[model samples]
Target: MAMQDLDPSEFKTQAPDAHGQVSTLKELGDEMKAKLARLGLMIAEEAGAGTYLQRDQTTSLCSTRSKGVEVLPIRQALQRYDWLKDYSWVAVKADTDKFTRDAASAPPDVVQGYFVRGLKGQVERAPVQTCLYVESRSTKQVVHNIVIAEEGSEINIITGCLAHGGIGRAMHEGISEFYVKKGAKVTFTMIHEWQEQMEVRPRTAIVLDEGAAFINNYIALKPVGSIQSNPIAYLNGDNSRVMFQTILYGKGSSRMDLGSRAVLKGRNTSAEMVSRIITRDKADVVARGLIVGDAPGAKGHLECRGLLLSDTSRIDSIPELDAKNPDVNITHEAAVGKISPDEINYLMARGATEDEATSMIINGFLSFDLSELPPEIAKETKKLVDQTMKGL
Candidate 1:
């Protein structure tokens, strides 16, 4: 069906449960909207027309696992708000056949908002089953403006994008503007997986305010083509902090570009970035990190590591530290190589096949350090990563 034909009104919005319990989708969307509206009101009251001028740009695409799933076009949900006309962000998910053929033939509504529009409280979170296929073949773009309001308010968002069939190409561009008044927190998590022929490129920008905290985590495994992502965070408020972590694995002919960055502009601000990448077969992987301290008492740190399972596989690491303040503390570390021969030999002596040994070692490498996550999420993430590594 054409994107324009899929009416948002047709999708039933269920009422609250008997006890006034909010459904998953409604609760998420409403919470995001409330926060966004609060920030919009503040901007309108404080800066008047000038508040609208500071919006950011974003664009994105996804095409690896599109199959027999309902690919909801974001434009439908966005049209509900008039403020979106000034900025644009577009995303599409579908299977290979539908994406390459039907997607290309779909009406212009599917591809509209290429460069102009703004998005607010556009939140979607759901526990997608493994069978729902989504694909993005054509190039996609998005420009987004995100704002967060005052002390004690918080916004938490979670999303899982997966493909259970065929392969395709996808891209994403995102920008977030945060106005953290006094003390507030925003936590976001995005997880992705694709078939052997998919390619994905995702970019993000985040701005932080005083006494606020931001935590973002991205996990990508078993992509058939190439997966590249850039996550940037700007700490513009004193005593604010940001934490970012990325985990990725590539096999077959796949490649991955994964990294995170933070810029500290206020005193007592802090940032941390950690990453891990695994490459097998003839795959190539690159992990980059950067941390900048721009104000007195600001602090930053970064670490990245890559593991190569095959002699022909390749891995690269680029870590940077830029500091303008003498009192600031910043550090970084990078490593690129393979599993130790001794470790492999030890596993082989225990009667494990080379492949089995390699898989076990690789799983162990990615399993550690997830202790901080809630038990349920950590368990699910570990299981998913293990399943993805079996293909290697």
Candidate 2:
């Protein structure tokens, strides 16, 4: 169904036993844990600093293993800390869209989502893992997440979203807000694994303080009915920096519109937006990036690359740069093309079969540099990418 035809009120808001409690990921059934593992969750050992899980419209797990950070359900956090009101719904307005309105209008008792905070002067050694799973068919899961890194602190997070493999159809809407305080750093990696009939929409906004840094990595390599996401970051403090990297594989008849924006409002601040997309079958993909420099000494760049693997598939790369100040430096570049015959022929001449050469090229095309991610998360991300490439 088209987005305009979707009625957010038609889906059930509650599922039976969805609020059941679990102290650890191992408490979950083997089948469920295996599914989560494919989506980048560390289920075998407690290797992460924290873990949060939301099943359907309720929280099933929320725990933190480190004293430097705190992880709790959104509702509990809101009730425990009055200062949270200043940050909640501030980065992203609650009335911005219908999905946001749906999540905002939920009753207090049924509210679902996670709240994560990193204390001042502390650095978490492992990444915090979170998951939003849709277990009931035709269910609409709407959640709001907040993440904060206090001054001089550092943290890494890995989040995954997916639907049950057996589910015929479902919908997911998520709103996320992030705050990086002065001299703090935050690394966020998100992986999406959805069924063929799932529709996903995510709204996100981030703000940075003086000397703060934010690195974002996104990976989506599965069949889905449709997905539309555009996350924006604002560098409001002097010397703050932000970088966004996205990797996508679109197959079947899936439709995807993914983009990122950065507003450089502080002197000496910088931003980067990079994307790599591959499409096959009858898939339609649009990759977009924008950088706006509003400060005198601001610098920014935007890049997008696309590869078409099937004759019927389509890819559109749009890269834009806006310099509002005379002294600012901004640039952008975009390219969309298919595998070159010369490169394939050169590989074949090196004693590789045609099929083997093509596979090698495709694998290299989709590979990403995971050096920025935490060691454990980097390992999981590499495994996930290898598994996704096997189907191609």
Candidate 3:
């Protein structure tokens, strides 16, 4: 049979089967909701979107919820705010069924996302938030969100992912696409908080127009069974800018392979990729970053840092840069090692126990300078970041 002739949903481990057996647990109650809220999402809970999804008794499936009580689909959630009406869950099954490169132009319905309304030359005032919660057994879920900032406009978006208790092995796959038009700026922040047994895969891509800017921030503070992802950004127009910042903590027997790639294809384009990884227990982690400059006057930098908390844990940093233009500037740096005992001793000498001293060092290392983000977004995400650092 031809590739196009097969059943599109048959291979989907997260999609509904012939007998409609997609959910591992038939329904969820208050207990699971509380669990989801406390698992590194107290900020989201305070914002009233902690458990952004819930199960409807009649359907036995999960749906996006508003305020923990009102059952709302992503479409309806988009309708709540007039400013969000321009956005939607536009990706089709074609986008999420596979890891194809055409996701930005041809998105499948299986993907959940929206298209931001572009302003000819203005900034959007409201910050968009996409909160998701998955609590099903034998479940595999995929999310694909698209954002397009019109020329001369600016916008901010925050994406949060969470899974219910570790009942069985559950999976979540995600894809995101961003189109920054000429002179536009788009800032995106991703927060992943899943249980120990869940698996996650996130695929993201971005395209920038002349003078456009794309800022990406990623944080994973909890232990997961496994996660593998690589997000790519393309600076295709003159003077475009793309920066990626990430912080992760991998624990237990988890495995994490995360990376970011930037292609500077336009004159005077600039890019940066920074990542920090901390591993504990038997976790295996890799931090990968790459920047390619193909245009004259393009400049880019890549950096990766790691901290090993357990002797059996492993952390690897990979940084790469490819420059085709002699006039361009590109550089990369990577470092992986255990926390320095000298740093801990210094803190301990200042009136703290060994545990407290170690905690302080770990927290300081894991904490990021939010000054890199937009004012509003930085202010909002700082709380979540602080909570994550302390909890870990």
Better of 1 and 3 by TM-score: 3
**Candidate 1: stretches off by over 4 Å:** 1-150, 167-182, 344-360, 371-375
Of the two candidates 2 and 3, the one with more favorable TM-score, higher being better, is 2
lDDT of each: 0.52, 0.86, 0.66
Quote the positional error of residue 81 for candidate 2 in Å: 0.5
- The Cα error of candidate 3 at residue 93, in Å, is 13
Residue pairs of candidate 2 with colliding backbone atoms: none
Candidate 1 is scored at a TM of 0.63
Worst 10 residues of 1 by lDDT: 49-58
| Number of the top-ranking candidate, with lDDT as the measure | 2
What are the per-residue Cα lDDT tens digits for candidate 3 across 251-368? 8887888999989999999998888888889989878888899999999999888898889999878788888889899998888898788988898889889889888887777667
- Write the number of the candidate with greater lDDT, choosing between 1 and 2: 2
lDDT of 2 at 172: 86
- CA lDDT of 320 in candidate 2? 80
Model 3: which ten-residue window has the lowest total lDDT?
A: 50-59
lDDT of 1 by residue, 1-392 (tens): 22223222221211112112222212323433343232222212221111111111111221111121112223442566455333332112222222223333434343321111112322212211111123334333222333343355554433444432432443332233334445666555556655565444444566677887777767777555665666677788899998887777767887777788888998999988877788778877778788888999998888787887788888888898998889899998887787878888899999998878877888877764554443334555666667666766
lDDT of 2 by residue, 234-347 (tens): 999999999998999999999888899999998999998888899999889888888999998999988888889999999988788888999999998888899889989999
Report how far residue 254 has shifted in candidate 3, in Å: 1.2
Query: Cα deviation of 203 in candidate 2 (Å)?
Result: 0.6
